[model samples]
Structure formats: structure tokens, C-alpha cells
Target: MIDEVMFMRHGRTAFNLQRRLQGQIDIPLDIVGQWQVDMSGFTLAQRFYWAKVSNIARHPDRLSQPSDPPIRRSDITEYEQAPASRRRMVVVSSDLFRAQQTAHAFADPLGLDVTLDSRLRERDFGQWEGMSREEINERYPEGYASWKAHEGGEAAYGVESRPDLGKRGSSTIRSYCDDPQYMDEPTTLFVVSHGSWIAATIGNLMGLPDSQLDNLTGMRNAFWSRMEPQYTSNSVLFHLTEYDKGPDVADAVDWENGPAYLRNPDMPMWKPLI
Candidate 1:
């Protein structure tokens, strides 16, 4: 029975800035990306006490009522002074550079080490790897249209199929849930991964419908979603603290002269709803 799980999408990168398909190219985070992660770390440090302190330390008075509020440090300096009082935090990152960097931002603040997992890598884009939407449309018009229409299934050229990608996402998530260490108690696991993989994983865990699958894309760079596990006999269930629905919106029209969602879609509907 895992307690809380947080899925963090890596910060922006050069490819992201250009609106290009990075796939697994191992792009590093840009300056803005780094700043975004720093703020996230700062925010987390404020809310909960780090795990360095025992669970007992978090609840000094064992008899404290459930209505008792969490014991949070008044200042950052005070929080850092008592290393023993810090809460325990485990960071897991995709092998990709962007994700690793984002994980580092959170791990460094808590004085924790990051565990890299290849299983968390992004969906391989294959031939569409470094191309932007326009380029992909121009070069592989037929494949692009088919991919969008199906939401996913046919790989762009020789890339990984949507069904396979979704399965990989589901399996990776299940692996963490089934791990004895994470299930030992109420643990918080910060999984730093790609947007596509995150979306697919959430959809897989919740068994979302095809039409609703695209709703998961509202996860902006460096943002995160909190999830909790609900175990059942036949399957593992999860509940998201929050998920963004509706089409992606931009402040202004994109260079494509259309809404961001219409211009560049991001959905992982490899198979029709069952």
C-alpha cells in the first residue's frame, strides 16, 4: 500500500523551446528549465518535513490527534539546521538528461541521491526524432495524419508503436508500486519523466477513454501531479490529485496560425477503448 506518488515532468529544453520532437535525444535543460526546477524544490521543502527524520520525529507526540497540523519549519535556514528532522525523500529519474537534471534539482535540496531508470525513458520518435511539427508534417505527411487520426498505434516511420509505449509506461509504474521498499510505508516517490510517457502512464493506470486521453497533456514543463494507489484483486488502481483537461492553450496564436493543440497534438491513444 504505497501512500503518495508524484510524477514530475522534466523542465524545458532546447528541443522543447523549438517545439521539436526530442524523443530520447538526451537534451539538457535550458536556463529557464533549471530555474523552474529550482523553484519546485524550494516549494517542496516548505510544505513537508524531509524524510531524514524518522516518522516518529514527524509526529513527536504519538498521541497527537489526526487534526494536528504537520510540523513544518518556520524558515529554510531552520529546516536545514536540523538534518535529523528532515523527511525522507526518494528521487527516481529517467536516464534522459532533461529528467535527470530536474530530479537533481529536487534531490540536491534534500541531500538525497537520484536513482536513474531506463524504463522511464520517453517514447522513441524514430525517424521523427529531431523534427518539429511542421517538418514532420512535410516529410511524413501520411504517417503524421494517420498518427493523429488514430491518436496513436502506427509508429512515426519506425518509432515505437502507441500500444507498446503505453504498455511500457504501465509496466514501469507498476514496477514502482510493487517494489517492497516503496510499499514499506507511506512513501513519496518523485518520478521524473517525459510528458508523453507521463500522459500514457496516467491513462494506463486509470484506464482513461480514448477521447479523454489527450486531457493529460496540460501538464506544463516542470509541473507535477500527485497520485495515490488503490489496490484491487484483479488490478492496481490510482487516483490523481489533479489532471488538466480541455485543449492546450497559448497566450497567442502559434506560428502555425492555429491553437497549439490543433497545430501540434500530443496524445497516446494506441488502441481503441475496450
Candidate 2:
């Protein structure tokens, strides 16, 4: 059974810094984006190790007693040395360059390969692909207003509808869960994608209305959300557990408008959560 799915947004890009719509454009990560990926990747690796240890500790026959010693790094090391088949976490990413760059960071630490899926790409922004918010507002004021209102103006501009993007993302994830190779294993699937896609997909999976989804904040670069599957007799439902989690320092500031601490190469990487 695929128990957990994590959706991660790719690190910042030149277009992201310039506040331009990248859409399906093949943008590479900037220097700062590379730094963000390195930090996030290390933290994610720690989380994977900790989760594996916790699972073993919670095993029916091996439950830890109240007096048991605290989990140590040695314990995690031991778990890491276990057979590969016993640790079945799969990393999947959008085939776009930025997403693939972010995916490799986390995958490399776990000695896993990243599986690319085109369906996970960012929403097509059409003619507005290279435009910044300011440019869009200046060139297509009415369409911009309509888009802000979540009306149908975006259709005229050839942008992918939010609902369609959600369906594409959600269905892509569902297909992986239903695959026979991973169906019987307690697999953890990591999907490295884009901000809008992640948000839309989460809203769709949770069966939330567009109005409710509008209230949810967009995920920052290199941040991730986690969902766990709840299996019923006939269907599977995913429940959101964590949202927009990343390095500890990032928790306090909105990177989009805040100071450029993440851009500093000297900034210390956060210690592992585990």
C-alpha cells in the first residue's frame, strides 16, 4: 500500500525571482535555488530515515517499551544498511528541468532514481508564459482582472483552467498508487512539481471547493506538503498532514516578500527534524 505521498515545489528559478510566469518553459534553477535544493534535500533524507526507524519501532512485535532508550543515529544507520527492497520510497518529478533538478537532490541521498512524468508539469500559461504580473496587467488588464477574480477570462488567454490542472495532477498521482509494482509495499512517494499544480492537486484530492482552495497560501520554493492515504472498503482517500514545511528558519518568514536569507551561501542549513 502506498501510505504516504509528498508533493514538493521546485526551488526558485530566474523567472520566479523576476515574478514571471514560467509555465512549461524550461527554466534552470539559479544559484540561490541550488542552495535551497541542497538544504531541503538533506532535510528530506533525514526525514525518510527517521520515518523508517519509527515504522520499525512501531511494529506489532517490536513495539518499544516505556523504558526503552531514545532513538540514536546508530539506529538510523542500521536501518539505512537494510535491504533496498525493505525500504521502498519512490521519487517522481515533473520532466521539466527545474523540477528534475529539485528531485535529484532528495533522490541522491536515498540512492534512488527519479521517475519523470510529463503530467506533473506546471500549468500551461499560454501567451502569458514569459510575462510578469506587471506585464500581464499592463497588456491585458481585463483578462488579468478576470483571472484574479477566478472567472473565465483565463480561457480567452489560453491559460489552463485550475480544475483541469487539478485533475491532471491528481490522476497522475493516483495512477502511480494503483501500479502493481508498488501496490503491496508500504511505499512513500515523493512528487516534485510546481506551486500551482501542488495546490490544485491537494484541493482536488481533498474534495475542496475552488473558493476554499483560494484561501490556501501558495507553497514557497523548495517547500513540501505531505498526505497520507486512508483505505476504505472500496476506495482510498488522502488526508493532508503537513503543508509548506521546509527548513526551520523558513518557517517564520515568507520568502516571497521577506529578506533574502536563503540566497546567502553563508546561511546555515537547518538541522534535521529527526
Candidate 3:
């Protein structure tokens, strides 16, 4: 079984800065976005160190086992894995430019190949693509109102339906989980995609109710959320382990209710500098 899945949102973009609807527009990361990815990569390096350190501190006997992985610092671009460490990871990213860029940030440091998957791309915004909220409200008032009234079920002309997006999210997870390569190892998979896709994927994995689905918040740019398995007799269920990041709006998250120390005690505190 896959040990854990980490979902990370792409870094900031020109459209993100303007609060514009990206929706698979293929925007490149801006300067600040590039910096965010760089720093986030370093943070990930630190995170691995602290994760093992904490585990050792908590369970001393585990250290005596030669099979235990030795935790060591990497130069951020090339990491050497101990024989036991498997320091291995897989990065799956949306085909869009921004998402690919974000995946590269981590893949470069962790020495993992990025698997490009269109299934992980952001929802198709269609007519709303590249438009800001105010622009949508001003130019397509009726369509905007309809979308809001029906939540995501309805959308502007040519837009993909919310139900379809949900289905895609569900299928993406199912397909990846069913892959023999991933299932055979205790691999850590990093899924780099857009905000909407990430939330929808997580919600589907957790089997959250429909009403609560739309309310799930997204992580900040360059930030990540973690999920791990809860094995059951008939099947395995995944649970959110760590969350809570900056650039978030009021009250959108309800799943994890934490930047839980269980998996992410070492992550840097989120600061919305951009």
C-alpha cells in the first residue's frame, strides 16, 4: 500500500496575483512564484530531516535497527538516499505550465521524475477563463448569479460542469492508487495540481458529503497537504493528516483541523508575503 500522498498546489502566477480565474490557462510562475517554489523546496528538505528526527526522538529503539533509514541533509538539488531510506518519491503533475513548474521544484531536489497527467489539470473555466471575479460579475452577471445559486453545478456557457470535475478527481485518484508500481511499494507520491482539483481530489478520497465538498479550503501556493491510509478489513480509507496554510480566506477548511504535528511539525509557518 502507498504509505502517504502529498498534494501540493502550484506556486503563484500572474493570474493568481490578479485574482483571475486561471482554469487551465497555462500561466507561468511569476518571479515571486519562482522564489516561493525555491524556498518551499528547501523547506521540504528541512521537513524530511525533522520528520525522522522526531520519529527517532519518540521511538529510540527504532534507531538500533540496521534496517532503519539514516536521515541526512541534502544539498537541496541532489539527495542521497540511505540503503534503507528509499528516500524515493514520485511527483505527478498537471500538464499545465504552472503545475509542471511547481512539480519541478520538488522533483529536482528529491531526484524524482515528474509524471505529467492531464487528469490532474485545473477545471476548465471556459468562458470564465482568465477573468477576475469582478470581471465575471460585470460582464456575465446572469451566468455568475446562476453559478452561485446552484453552487458549482451550473457555470458559464462552455464551462465544464462541477459534477464532471468531481468525477475526474475521483478517477484520477482511483487510477493512480490502482497502479501496480505504486501499490507494490511504500512510496510517497506528490501530486502537484491546481487548487480546485486538489480540493476535489481530497474530498473524494475522504468520501466527504456533497454539502461540505464546496466548502473545503485550498492550500496556499507552494504549500502542501498530506494524507495517509487507515486500513480496514474490506478496504482502505485515507485521512487528512496535515493542513492549514497562509493565503487562505475566512473559513473554508474542516477536514484535518490542523497543521498536525503527526506529519508536518517541521513545515515552516505559512506567511503570505506575496
Candidate 4:
């Protein structure tokens, strides 16, 4: 009974290329983003035997249906159980286009159904939803420090506070992990969501301090971040209670593992400051 959570950052969005704080911005993934995610999916799927798609299907009742199909598999023809890999699961993004599209790449291979949930949506940026950090600083400098500090009392015009992001977004993930529909399966869990939401989710779960939280940025689209949960007598029972962060092989995680486009499987080197 190994509890594993794979937090995948969404693929490259227009906001990502601009070096802006996407913060709940609903931008589509670029071509490179698609490639990145697909690569992650392939690599991770190979490592595991079966994959559970994040695109969980819900009946009108909103309860996740067990009979719900998976979005991807080990084999393209019929998703056979591979001896070398473990079972994998894909959690489709609630963001219609990005999530669905990302799910399609994996689902089409295994013929699994993609599960969708609004709760997994990126952090609602509030007033800052679509604007970049530079724009925020140019327009309102006073609010910037509060934002950097993650002080939620005051807001940057209409953006969501760090506190609110932690409260709602983190709560949603906790509920998801507890919910049988998302967890309860033995396969690996792959979550697809916005950058801010991903950071907030991990930060809140780990109780990351404000300084640590502020240092994070969004996950690169389609890249998988590693996390593991250990069994402890005192910890919550029958579930993945609190996971550990692993080095993000895809270079996409709660924090940037290293500079992008620097990965060379053959060379295998990690250096700061790309």
C-alpha cells in the first residue's frame, strides 16, 4: 500500500513564455508545453504499470463512478499490465481545453476516460487573474510587498490573497485526496492544474512557511513532479496521509528544479542559473 501523489504542472502557456505570474490565468498550452507533458506522461507511464487519468468522470450526482473508464494505459492496443512499470492514473484538468487536451494524449493511448473536477482549477487570481507581476508592480507597488509576504488581509486590487488561495485551494486538494474517487486506487495519481493552485496546494499540504511559498512559481505544463507517502501508525489510516517531495525529473514541480531545456538524459547534469 504505497501512497503516491504525482503533481504535474500544466504545459507551457502563453503566460509562461512571457515570464508573467499566470496566477489563475486561463491560458492555453503552447506546442512546446504539449511536448513537455507528453514526454512526462510517457516516461512516468513506463515507470509504472497502470495510469489513472485525472479526468475522473462524475455522474450528475457528483460522486465519482468506479466504473468510470481510465484515460490512458500501459499499452496502446489494450493497456496491458506491464511487468516493468506500475499502474498510473491521470487526473484531467477541470480547465476544459487544457485538461481535456492533455488527457487526450494519454487517454487515446490506453482508452481510459478522463475525470474532470472544478475544484482542481487553478487559484482564482481575483483581480490579478490575468495580469503579470511586472504589470502588478507598475500599477500598484504598495500591494506588492504584501503579496510577496503572502499577507492576505489586503489584496492587489481584485486578486485572491495568499491566505484565501491556501484556504480554498488547499482544502480542495485535501478533500480530493480523501475522496475515494481521486485516491483509493493503487495506481499513481497525476494532477493537472494551474501554476498558482499547484504551488498553493503543495505549500499548504506541507505547511510550507510564507517565505518558502513565495519562492515558488507555477509548474511547467505537462511535467510530472514526484511525491511519496509513508505508512505510520499514528498517521491517518487507510490513505495517503501527507506525501514527501521528490526531485522533479521533469524539472516541473512546486518549484523549478532547474533551468528549462537543460535536460539531457544522456548527460544528466543539474546546474542553477540557466
- The CA lDDT of each predicted structure is 0.69, 0.80, 0.69, 0.55
TM-score of candidate 1 against the unseen true structure: 0.73
> What is the C-alpha local distance difference test score of candidate 2?
0.80
User: What ranges in model 2 sit over 4 Å off?
Assistant: 50-85, 251-274
Candidate 1: RMSD over Cα atoms? 10.0
Model number with the top lDDT: 2
Candidate 2: pairs in clash: none
Q: Judged by TM-score, which candidate is best?
A: 2
RMSD in Å for model 3: 10.3
TM-score of 3: 0.73
Candidate 3 or 4, higher lDDT? 3
Number of backbone collisions per candidate: 9, 0, 0, 38
- Scored against the true structure, residue 107 in model 1 reaches a CA lDDT of 71
TM-score of each candidate structure, all chains considered together: 0.73, 0.81, 0.73, 0.64
For model 3, the run of ten residues with the poorest summed lDDT: 254-263
lDDT string for model 3 (1-274, tens) is 5677888888878787678889989899876667666656666755554334333333444354344458553232211233324434667899999988988886665445688999999989998899987888898888888787756634546777655676797788766666787665466777888888888778877887766667787677778888886557766678999763432321343212222322245333323334
Q: Tell me the tens digit of each residue's lDDT in model 1 across 1-274.
A: 4566788888767677777889899899866567666666566545444553433354444323455458543343433456544434567999999999999877765556699999999989888899987798887788888877766634637777655666798788788778876655556777889888888788877787656665655466777777888888876788887552111222232311233342235422122112
Q: Where is model 3 more than 4 Å wrong at Cα?
A: 49-83, 150-153, 231-234, 246-274
